[model samples]
Every structure is written in C-alpha cells, then in structure tokens.
Target chain A: MSSVVIVGAGLGGLRAAEALRANGFTGTITVVGDEVHLPYNRPPLSKEALAGGVDVPGLEFRRKASIEDVDWRLGSAAVSSDLAERTVTLADGTTLAFDGLVVASGIRPRRLPIPGPQEGRHVLRTAADAHAVRDRLRPGTHVLIMGAGFIGCETAATARALGAEVAIVAIDEQPMVRPLGAELGAGMRRRHEEHGVRFHLGHSIDSFVGDDHVQVAVLSDGTELPADVVIEAVGSVANVEWLAGNDLDLSDGLLTDSAMQVATSSAPVVAVGDIARHPNALFGSVARRIEHWNMPTETGRRAGATLAALLAGDEPDRGPFCAMPSFWSDQYHHKLQSFGMPGIADRIELVEGSVDGPCIVEYHDASGLVGVVGVDRTQELAPYRKQLAARAG
Target chain B: MTVKVFVDMDKCQHYGQCCFEASDVFELDEDGKLQYVAEADESRRDDIESAADVCPMQAISVE
Candidate 1:
C-alpha cells in the first residue's frame, strides 16, 4: 500500500486529506502539525475569536471523530525533509517515509524588530495568540496596530468593538491602499474613523517602548502615542525553512509548477496554500503566492487530485489551476468582499453606491475588469465575478 | 433525492459566503441573516457541498 505524508495539519492539509479519500486513494495518510489543536479555521482568529465571541474549540474544522483513518502527528513540527530518501524528520526526531508528500505548512506571522519585552506584544496567527490579544482588550485599553493590512484593520475593528481605543499606524497613505486601492482604502478608513478608531497613516514605527510590555510606540515623525498593547500585523513569512538544504527553490515560497507539483523533486511531491508559489494563469501566468482564505481550499483540491493520480499510476489532468480568488472580512456589521486580483488593477471605479455608503467597486487593468470589491453588497458581486473569470479565461 | 443541510448557528457568522456558492439554496435575507432551503434537490449537492467547504466558520454540513 502507498503512503502519503502531509505536513501542516491546517486547512490545506486537512482538505487535501479529504480530497485524497474522495479520489479513492486507499493509502496510508499521515498529517503532521505543530499545533496540538486539530485543523481549525484561522479566519475567525482576527474577528470573532479576538472579540471573545467564539471559543477556540468551536473554530475546529471538524470534530475529532470525523477525521477518519489518518495518522495524526499533532504538536510535532517537520524539522527537515530529505527529498531523495522521500522522508521527513519531525522536531521530535522521528522520520517518516512516504510515497507521496504534500507541503502545506503555511506561513507564520511576521514580527517587528523593535526592542521591548514580548509579554504584551501580540500577533494574531494562532488561536492562542487571538485569546491573548482578546484578554488584553479591556474597555478603554489603547491598542497600537503597526500594520494597515487586512489582519491589522480587522483586528482594529474587533478591538474597537470590544470597547478598546484603537489606533492604526502604517506607512501607506491609507489603510489597505496597495491591495484595495486608495478609494476603497479611504472609504474603509472613513468607516473606521466613524467608529472612533484613529489612524496615523504615512508614518513608520521607530520603536516600541516599555519595561516589560509595550506601552508607547514612537513613530518616525517623532510622534509618541501611549499604547496599552501593541499588535504587529506586518504580514507573514512562508514556513519554507525546513525545505532548506534541498534542491527545491526556496526563494519566496516552495516553487511549484502550475499544477502545484514541486519543481525540484523527482518524487511525487506537491504544495498548496500560502506556502506554494506557482504560476497563476489569471495574472498572465505570473508566479505569486496567494495568502487569502480560499486559497487553501482551491489549491488543496488540485494538489490532492494530482497527488492521488500520480500515486494511482495515472496521468493527472495538468490543466492550469486557476480559481477565482475570493476573500471576505466582516467588521462591525460591515461585510467587505473581494474577488480576483485587485492589487494588479490599473484603474478602479465605483460601479454601485457611493464611497461613503455601501458600495460595489470594479477594478480594471489594460485587459479590462479584473476584480470586484463589494462592501455589504454581496448579492451584486456574482455577475461581475463571472465576467471577470470569463475575461481571464 | 433531496440533500439535507444542517448549519450550526452557533458557529455560523452569517458571512454570506455560502450564498455565493449555492445561490438557489442559501440566501441572506435583507437583515444579513442566512436563510437556506432545508431540503435542496440532489442536483445542487455539489453546490451545497461547495458552500459548506467555503464557509469560513465551518458551520455548514450536508447529508
């Protein structure tokens, strides 16, 4: 019987396992994860989980009894991999051989270089991190969020919802401008401002100051703000360090073909989710790493299908795997949804409603409409997304 | 055959992602609350399953 070893028991890893069974792969499957918790949803960590509205156990993707017949190596991280030997070494120094390997280790939260005790400084990537941040979000507590990215903005909204005074500091002219464009970002900024969240845009963090925990953040403009807690939502780094010393390209993420097959491995190895950087035909075949919520599901399906076919001694459908990327964020009753690659658009227009009100924004590049962003207008997004997908094809 | 759907309201955030996946089955009312057909045609099983898969909260299940 063939054996498959999957690293990172997150959404991608778990979904791939399900797909393996769905594809009739009657083989031994082992899922290794660093976290003790079973595969849980990460999207709620910044919103409902951080606001203390949901318990950690409720975030699990499925109940333990539903996981089926898979060797689960929880709380053990993959320390290294030997591609030639088709084996993986875990942090506990256990080695496992496999006929198929799926690398879905995902990314870790990026940290700030500022000097301060790590007691109160937080980054929301895990369930424990969200609980820690939630515990500190007492009413009137001042929070200094050091990035205007999705995680930062969503956390800001949650913090404010919890009655904490939140201030966002970022170098962008407006929060989320690089991805959502200036107009939408400005609109989102206005919404946050209306909710009493402060913004210090176009400013960089100089350093964090406190004895045992961050209490004050000094900006590069020499402006000092008193903060009870500081959150570093800068971004994330792909967990590809273990793939080092191997021939695999570890420049950005694990470089993979369009089908998510590892480029350097002769063995049947594939990657999925945030750690897999592959050519996206939607963006003119540009190799990019998508860290959105839906990526793991879409890519996991593809990777699992491909690996199962290879193990079954069959030729996998090697079509370009391009699924319309969609992501949604809920903040203080406002639902923000985006479809497609908005960052690459050259022009953006408000197709429906006004900037100050709930709206649908259309993003267009030279090739025409490439993306659509809707705020509290989910029903109006479908046709635009269909058209965008058709155009991409 | 009809597919039976169950949504754990405690886990559901009513994000409306399921609505996009299975438009004929899942709908978000004007108040932004999720309403769905308890018994959907088996033809929509794929769509309903996709809805369950795309749910960020993992609150939806089909049988």
Candidate 2:
C-alpha cells in the first residue's frame, strides 16, 4: 500500500496517522478535516476555556515526530466516497485515492428542531462555538440550557462562574442522569444548585421566543425562563453522510468488528474513534460507540494496526479489543471521573465517602462490577480501571 | 541509552492518566500531585510516550 487517507483531523485522526507510522507502514498519509484547525483538546472547551476564554492554539494537540510528514488537508470536508473505486471526493471537488481508508469523521452536535430564533442559541463543540458563547456570557446574562447532560451541566457551572444566571431545563429527573444515575446525578444537581445554578428538571424547552435573539425560553411546564442565550446540549449526530452509498452499517455509526475493520466493506476500510461502533470483550459482544475522550486513542491504535497489516497483505490480530472507556467532567471545583460504562449498570453502591463530597461509586450489572466513578478520587481510580479492563475469555 | 522525561508543573492537571501508561515513570503523590522521573532507560520510551499521549493537559514531554 502506497497511500492512506484519514477523514477528520481530530485526536483520532492524529493518533491513527501516528499509529500507522509506528506500525512500520511507510505509506503517505493525508488527513482531511472540515475544521481549519488541527486536532485540539475539546474537553476543556466546556470548563476552563469556557470560563477563561477559548484559545485554539493553546488547545491544539501535540503531534509526535513520526507523523510530522503526514499531509493535512484542512478547511474542506469529505463530501462523498466511492468504496468500489477507493476514491473519496472532497467538498473542494478533489478526488483522492488511497490503499487504506480511516473512517474517523467523528460527530457533530445535534440541534433540536424547536420553534425558536436561531440567533442566540448555541451548542458547545468547536473552538469557535466556545469563543462565541463566552463573548455573550457575562454578569446579568441568563443562560437557559436545554439538556441535563454533562455538557449542559458544565456550561451551567461555567456560566454561573462568569456571574451569569444559569437555568437548566431537561426531561430527566436530574443532571447527568444517564451516566451517574438518578441518585448520584441528583447529588450533582445539588452541587450545581449550591453554586447558584437553577434546575427545572422533568421539563423541556417548548420554544425560544424573540424577534431576533432569544429573549425567553418557554418550558413544557409553562414556566417561561428569561434567556439571553440558550445552549442546546442534547447529543450528537455521527458524521456518516460521506460514507453513504457504501455497503456498510452506518445505522448508529460505522459498525466494526472487534478488530476495528469495517463490517462487510468492499475494501480495506477501517473505522475508528467515536464513529466506530465496535465490541469490547470486557463488556461482552455488544458493539457500542463510546463517546469518551480516550476511545480515539484506543480505537485508533487498533485501527492503525489493522489497516497497516491489511495493506501489507498480512492478517491482522484477531484479539478482542477491550479498551476500558473513561471520561472526566469538572463542574466548579468538583471533579467527576468514570471508568467503563456506568450507564449500562443496573446497580450502584457508594463504596467510599459521601455523595456530597469526595466519593467512589461502584456500578454493577448482574455479571459483576462493570464500572466505577471517582469523585475527587483520581489517584484511586487506577485499580478500578484495571479491573474493568480485564478481559474474560 | 537514556531518555529525559518532563512534566510541566504549571500545565499539569494531575489527572493521573499518565500513571496508567508508565507507572514507574509517573505517579501521583499522596496529595494527588503528579511526580515523575526526569531521566529513565530508553527501553521505557514506548511507555513514556504513551503516557505523554494520554495526558489530557498535554503537559508531558520526553526527550
């Protein structure tokens, strides 16, 4: 194989390129991304960057020396692909052929189709979005967040820290209910409330009312929230449009085997990062697209090895990919960290400390311990992470 | 061969993610602050590089 093209210039793309080189694949690599900037740390965009300010250069990922020669085609997106011809057409009308393809297009923030003026509504994803939202956040401003997810809750905390009034309206009973569970999630909501953030739980924003900018957020319960800005942190949509017409499972995301090889692809196509719904042996045979920050590094390593092997006309490792998914969230001074899929657990027990302060929560399914969350106990999470990462034969 | 490893004290968030990759080279102190060896055998380069890569703050540097 002489060439490889990686779609999406995020952390995943950078790692994939680095891995390709590390695996002794001396092919020319080109990364195509819609965003003009290279891969940057995005988790800070909601916390420090949101409250302090957005700095694209400061947030950019540090590339290893191995991938320095990789071509970066920024500012244009991959419009479509022809799997049979091994060609990808970019938005700039350039068609590029590759011996191996890395489907790392990642995801975009999903916007709700609510009746509202688009003007003051925003979603936190890119550097530009963070900067734009930060510019509007100040004292006397009211930010009505429309989702109770981590992003929404973090934005509430950041907005509140900026001296802006923050109100969260969501359909869930508590903030971060999906991952932290109702009990612990409620604890999180209380922490946010203690910091001057208001929660209108079990409510949805009916619409945003104003002539130009959002002036009021009408909740389903008929409570109208005065809003200077509305942040919709509902979820994300996989950027799989470019892979359309290809005979691949683009249902939720690009379905891949445990080896990161695209399922039933016409060529040596491998999907990685957030876009690949691959199974983990540690979690069972169920393929899940974990949106955690570490998934890109884990999947990219495996995908790069798989693609490099396939390009070399060699068989790839059939070993089960059992990466322990993890993510962290900072709201105010409290830091919440998790290892594995706590959302999949049916039972949870507070193993140490109280919910109001430093604590370690263990999540379990009928099988056994499936996840662990550490609240301000970062040092103690390593053992639990290793436990979740242990693969069962 | 020996490699020099450095962690920017100012930029480090002490998330302890690097400990998982190169526990021998990087570890959090009792106060949950990051402490790492400045120089190590080159055989540990792979582990040190992985530790640097996984750092969320991008505060680790190896030479």
Candidate 3:
C-alpha cells in the first residue's frame, strides 16, 4: 500500500506509471499534469499535427483502459515540493503526500525577450500551441522561424507544406549544423531551400517590429524582413522550478545519479525524460541532458524500476543506465534518424549512400565511433546502433 | 500457434522502424509503403512484439 506520486503526465510520466505496474508494484499511483488532456504523442505536434493532417485525439498515447487504475490529476500543476515532508503542492492549493516520487516535469520552450503585445508569435510545445500555429498558417501567410534546431526546421517544413511562405533566421552558420554536422546539415538546408523556404543563416533577431502583433523582424545586421507570423523554435528550458529548495544540483536540470535517483535528496526521488540530466555512460560517462523523443521511454523504464525496488524495500540492481539515445525527424520527403550523440563528434564520415539521396553518416571523435545519422536507412543503421550500444556498456 | 500482427494504417507513417525490428515479418515496399505478414510462427513472437514496441506512431499491435 505504498503511495507514489508522479508529476508531469506527459509521455515520461505515463510510461513510468506503466513500468511501475509492470514491475509488480501494487502501489497507489497518482499522476499530475498541467494540461487537461491525457498523455499524447508530442512528436507529431510539429509534423503531421501542425500540417492539419492529424487531430488532437489522434495524438493520444493510450486509451482509457490503459491508464484506468491510476489517479490522474489533469490540469493541475505542481507548484512546490517539500522534500522532508514528501509532499507536493499543486497550483489549486492541494497537497499530496507520497512514499515515492518521480519527477518527469519535462521542459518548456524558451522565448525571446521582445517588447510588444505578444500576438502572432507561436511556439509549438503543446497541442494548443500546434493548433494556434496551424490556424495561422494560411495559404499566403508569411512565417519567420527563429532558430535552426529540430523544432524550427520541422515547423518550417510543416509551414511550407501548408502553402505558407517560410523564412528561417538562425544564429548557426547552417541549419542543424550543431546536431547533424556540416555535411548532412547543409544537405538538409539545401532540401529546404529547394522546397521554397528561405534561410537567413548566421543572423540574430535585433527586434520584433509590430503595432499589436509581430509583422516584421529586424535583424542584427540591419535587415528588416516582413513576417505575418513569428515562431520561436530557439530551445527549451527544463521545468525544475518546483524542486527549488531541495538542495539538488540544478545547474542544468535535475541532476541525478547514474541510476536517475535524485543525487542530493534524502527522500526517494528519481527523475526521467528531458528534465533528467544524468551521467550517460554511452557518451564516455558524461553528464548530459538528452531532449530526444526516445529518451522518455528508456529513462522512464529505468526510473520506474529503480523506484519500485526502493519502495519494496529491496536494493535496486546496479548498472549504469546506458540506453542508446535515438531520434527521428520527418522533413519534406526525408525521414532522418540519428543514434548516439553526434554533436560531440570531431569527425563525420559518410558511410553509405549519397548526400542528396538516402545515406548513413558515421560520427567519430578521439575515442571512436560516437554516433550515426541516417536518412531513410533505418535498416542499415540498426547494426551500427547495436554495436555502439555494446561499446557503451 | 501463430502470432497475429496488426498495424493501423491510418496511424502508420511508414517509417520502417517496425521492419527493422521484425525484418521477416514486416517489409517496406519499393514505394516506402509498409507491407507485413498477417500471421507468423509463434517462435517469432518476441521479434514481432519488439516491432510493436519500437513503432513511434504506436500503430503496431500483436496478439
């Protein structure tokens, strides 16, 4: 009859609840989320969902039967948590005590500090955000996307697919250069340019110019571009404000041990998904925060198992959480899949296929093969990923 | 015994992630469309189930 409380009823929270049950933990489970809606798939929010191809219900991860046993606190945000009392206070002024806690609060999109009435500006993080952005992407609308990251590029692609004129203002020299390296990132930039999307690379926004809403963006190099709608895809900040007084390492995110256990908390608390910045042995035991799609499933399983063991008064098994990080993106006609951390690589070698066609690129640093990025070549990338995972262990 | 696999085409993006999990059971055609065997030997249940788990769209199900 142990009681476990999980914050953030997104993919990570939902999967952690399932894993807790699957691990034979017959405990009272409670999940709290700020959104009123149930846990849904987020990857589609920037792709098919933004393109008006899929509805909100279609993005859900589970049906009623899948999560019927858990107590769901939808639309309630956890405002604060008392470590010594093992209690969480919600925004609605309700507090819940727990024997075990899982922090999967995830991240929120970072916004630019611009003065003006914030309208016609969008950030695709939630279902509502996607809906608002999609509604504004009319046939002749002009969209100015800020940042060349995954979200920005995906939003640009979706905007173009919906017959909207898109222009990207990225601080990076080329689109996705930091993540996919120069060659593949350039290839992707070329593909987007061929599809009628404009790129203002190596540029920063000076100011957002408009009367009521953003209509034009003035660049740092003294160029003003007309924009009907502005989308900020800059980056995300970890949602770790609730655990403020816990004395945990909050340098980047909720710092966890190799097992995802809260390193500084005396209480049994673990973190998972995008908000959990722990030592990943795959990247040479580097403490990194991965914001990829597959991280929740992998980290949630580990965190759930660890918490279940601690709650059952049994010592958890000892092993470095070495889940191979992988993520995929669909832009234009290319399905880009990447495994391992490519951003840390010093050299990128083209292993198979051509840059314009389906290809696989291997990332290597001083150590060895660090990662691989492939376009529509999942089958070819499988063996390499397995090999990389083996090396990680 | 036979393992039955089901994929909701409406949800499937044809990413071929399932094909990588269970190559013998699921295959993407020349046009990158997904094609799969309706039923397979029970010995391949683990492979098929892995396919169901790795699907990003959650379109694949096994019975």
Candidate 4:
C-alpha cells in the first residue's frame, strides 16, 4: 500500500488525483491546499465574480467520479517538505509521509515594493481578493489598476461595467504587447480608451500618498492620479519555497522533464500547473511554465501517467510532452481567443478585418506560423489550430 | 457505456473548445453558439470526456 500527497487543491491537483484513479492507482491521495475552498475556476475571479460578487461554492470545479474519495486537506498550507524523507510538514506542524509526491503549489500575485497605504490595495487572484475588491468598486469610485496584462485589463473592464472610473498605469507601450503584439495590444488599448478607461503608459508607481488609505497614486513620471482603490495586477511569483532545500530548479518555477518528472529516478515526484516548468515539444525544448487555463489538465494528465508507471515499477514512455496552449479573454463584447505561443512571435500580421473590430491575427517567428489569435472568429480558428499543431509537430 | 452528456447552457460561453475535443458531440452553430448531442457512444467516451474537461467554463457534464 502506498500513499500520494499532492500540494495545492486547485484545478491541477484535482486533475492529478482523477488521473491517478483513471490510471488504476487505488492508493490514498491527499491534497493539501492553502485556501479553504476546493478547486474552483479562477478566471471569473477577475471578471464576473469580481463584478457581481464572489460565489465561492458556485465557482468550484466539478469533482470527477473517480476522485471522489481523495482526502482534501484544505485551509492548511504546506510549510515545508523533506523530499529525502518523503514527508510533508503542514503549517499546523502535522507531518505526513507519502510514497509519491505531486507539486502543484501554483503561484501568487507579485506585488511591487512601493511604499503605500495598504488599506485600499488589492490584487485579483483568490476569491477573497475578488470579494474585497468588489466591495470597493462602487459607482464613481476611482479604480487605479497597476498592470495592463489580461487580469488588469479585465479588471478595468469589470470596474467600468460597475460604473467605476478606471485608469490603467503600466510600463508597457500597449495593453498586452508581450503576448498579443503591439498592433493588437494597441487596438485593445484603443477599445479600452473608448470605454472611458485612461492609460498611463510607461509609468511605475513611485509611492502612495496617504495617511492610512490610498488617497493618491504618484507615478514614476511624476504624474499624480487620484486612486480610491488600487488594484495590482502586475504578475505572479511561483510558490516554490516549500521545496527550497530540495536542490531542484526553483529559479522561476520548479523545472521538470517533458514527462513532468522532477528528476530522472531519485524519487517519484512530478510538478504540474503554473509551478511546473515542463518542456513542450510544440514550442521547442524550452521548459516554460504557462499560466493558461488548460495547462493544469494537460500537465496533470501527463504527470499522473508518469507517476502511476513509476509506482508500478514500470518505466514510463519518455516521449516529448506536447500540448497546444489555448486561452480566451472576454473584455466587453470582444472575445480574444488564441492557440499556441503568440508571445514568441517576431512578426504579427493581421490576416482578416481590422483590430478594433472582429479580426484574425497570425503570429510568426523565423520558423513560420507559431500562433493564431481570433477575435469573434471562433468558427474559423479550428483549421488554424490544426495547421499550427501539424506545423509545430 | 453510453455516456449521457448534459451541458448547462447558462454557464456555456460558446468558446467552442469542446468542439475540438469531441467534434461529433459538441459543435458550434453558424451563429458561433454551442449545440451538442445529449447522447454519445461509449467508444467516443475519451474524446467526450476531453471535451467536457477542455471547456473553459466547465459547462459540460458526461455520465
């Protein structure tokens, strides 16, 4: 009899447990999570959940019949781990030994170290964060967003919908330049601006000006913006501190092989989701951790299969792990859907229509077509997805 | 094992991700809305399961 411990009870952990059962692993599976709530959808936390209200129970992931018996140790975060001893110590000092380990600890919002009044500060990551932000997003409230990524842009749209005066301050030239290229990103910025959202591009928050609550936001460019509620959607840091002394690659996230295995054979440990920097054959041999909505199921399925084979004393097939990363963003009526890594593209050409309206964009590097993003062009994307996969494969 | 598939339309975003996984079971109509067959063959269980799993909104449920 063997037991497996999976850290993080989000989509990644839940899928890993289901994958283990689907692979016929009848061992005890325990999922330890920092959050009290079970695995729920986080995307809505910035959009619908943030706008209307945070529905913690309604946002939960549907439990597959196979993983119904998994021991869900929620609310207790993993404080530390002894990989050599095969034991995990929780925050409450409870130590549990396991034969298998799955690292799905995920990430947290990265906050800038600017001196500020913390009372009106917020980050849209967890449900609680969404709830807290939602309370402050009343009509006519001045919402100052600190990032222009998907989360920041989405939060801006949500705040605008709630009648909040929205303003985005970031160092990027466009809203999503890193991922959607300058043309599309600028197009998105135009759309946001049309909706009354102000942009403070190429600026950083120098410090906050307030006694207790955030009354104003002072920018690096010496511009002062009145901010009633400050939402920091800058980025995220991988939560890999628990496995600090394990001698694993924690530079950005935990590094793993294509099979999601943390090592060759020292232990049966695999990492998944946002924490697992696993290599994808679709994007060369670069092991990058993607924070898209689909990576959990993709990596968890692969990780579970690898762990199950190891536990059965059989060598798992060492095939190159390949998964087409897909993500969709809904701000206002425009639905931005994408397949493949658009960020790595050197050339971005608009194939159909204009950027402000419905359009399709192709992202290509020197190698050829790398990704495709379609706005309100859902039906036409299937062919592009297949073509990209075949070309990359 | 004939799987009974039920999709909560209220929750469906019509992202058409499920159509990629199980094209025969879930399809996006001309209006780009989701339309699905409630009943599917057991042989297509893996693909249907993948369809339900890949759904961004998690609106599909197969039994």
For residues B1-63, write the lDDT of model 3, one tens digit per residue: 999999999988787777767899998787668899999999999679657766888898788
Q: Stretches of candidate 2 above 4 Å error?
A: A391-393
TM-scores for chain B, listed for all candidates: 0.96, 0.97, 0.97, 0.95
lDDT of 2 by residue, B1-63 (tens): 999999999888788889999999999888788989999999999999999888887898899
Q: Tell me the lDDT of model 1 at A292.
A: 87
Candidates 1 and 3 compared: the better one by TM-score is 1
Looking at model 1, the pairs that clash are none
Better of 2 and 3 by lDDT: 2
**Residue runs of model 1 more than 4 Å from their true location after superposition:** A63-67, B9-15, B28-33
- The C-alpha stretches of model 3 lying farther than 4 A from their native spots are A63-66, B1-3, B19-35, B40-50
Ranking by DockQ: 4, 2, 1, 3
lDDT of 3 by residue, A29-67 (tens): 999999988888888888888886547677777532345
Query: Candidate 4, residues B1-63: lDDT per residue as tens digits?
Result: 688999999888889999988889989998899999999889999899988888888888889
What proportion of the real contacts between chains A and B does each prediction keep? 0.35, 0.50, 0.15, 0.70
Model 2, residue pairs in steric clash:
none
Give the winner by lDDT.
4
Candidate 2 lDDT by residue in tens digits, A1-393: 389999999999998998989998998999999999998999888888998888899999889988989999999999999988999999999999998999999999988888978899999999989999999999989989989999999899989989999999889998899899888898898899899999999988888899988899888888989999888899999999999998778999899998899865467989889899999888888999999999999999999999999999999997988787888888887888898889999999999998888999999998888999988888888888887877454
- What residue pairs are clashing in model 4? none
Ranked candidates, highest TM-score first: 4, 2, 1, 3
**Is 1 or 2 the stronger prediction by DockQ?**
2
Worst 10 residues of 1 chain A by lDDT: A58-67
Q: RMSD of each candidate?
A: 1.9, 1.1, 2.2, 1.1
Q: What value does the lDDT take at residue B7 in candidate 2?
A: 92
Which candidate, 1 or 2, has the higher lDDT?
A: 2
